[model samples]
Target: MANVSYFEAWGMWFDGRSTPGNDLLGLSMIWWGRFGKILSFVAGAAVIVDLLGPSRLSRYSDRLTGFLARRTFMATAGASFVAAITFLWITDPIGMHRLLQSVLCLTFVTAAGLLVTAVSRALPATHRVIRAASRERVVG
Candidate 1:
């Protein structure tokens, strides 16, 4: 087995071939590599959410944001595992693999965007306030 980065793992998965070997909970290289890609997105999203402000969907507590993030992440992880295994085992591996990969990539991008929005909301808005302070100091 060659050392592959997370991005390279996606290449291995979508190369229109499945390799032999199990690195992820007994899943073969194809499924494992795909799983790695999904899991990385899920984990990275969770971390970003954890570092961000409270969710608008919840009021008065950060716990709600954390809870929802955990639930959503777990749900994605579970669904990805089931879908990957189902497609790899019971259906056409190549077609299903591509489909699942696309779905996961879409989900990852959406989650990252949401995380960015949340964190941006927590950032201190300095443009107007700083400009006003500078004007006052200059005038005085």
Candidate 2:
């Protein structure tokens, strides 16, 4: 019989092999999973707040009502999609490539929605910085 180390007998090989291009996908999926929960919670809270009288979140004057509605729908759908994929993939990893494609699609949509929201939130600060720089250039 060939000599086997203790760790090898125990199946604890410390090989440093990795799946290329999978790290980013794995991290992105994790973020999406967490962000999905947050979005769902926010959506639930928004609905509760709306139920209460005169809430600021559902105000229609600034078009935030429509914006929030769309995002909430998208987030909920994406979360459900991710959950379904996870369940099916866990049951059988044979079709993991196909499952990953589905997950990537949902993650990309959620990421895009988040990116747009972030850019919109930063617009005022960005404008302020530009105005301040322009004023300094003119004055100096």
TM-score of each: 0.25, 0.32
Local accuracy of candidate 1 as per-residue lDDT tens digits, 50-119: 6652332123234434554556555445555555555445444445567776676556555655664454
Model 1 bad stretches (over 4 Å): 1-26, 55-140
Candidate 2, residues 1-140: lDDT per residue as tens digits?
Answer: 23444354334225643222232323533454578799999999988855753423223323643454456656555555665566565645555576676676566656655665665565555555555655675577
Model 2 deviation from the true structure expressed as Cα RMSD, one decimal place: 17.3
Query: What are the Cα lDDT values of the candidates?
Result: 0.54, 0.53
| lDDT of model number 2 | 0.53
lDDT value for candidate 1?
0.54
Q: After superposition, how far is residue 55 of candidate 2 from its true place, in Å?
A: 38
TM-score, structure 1 vs. true: 0.25
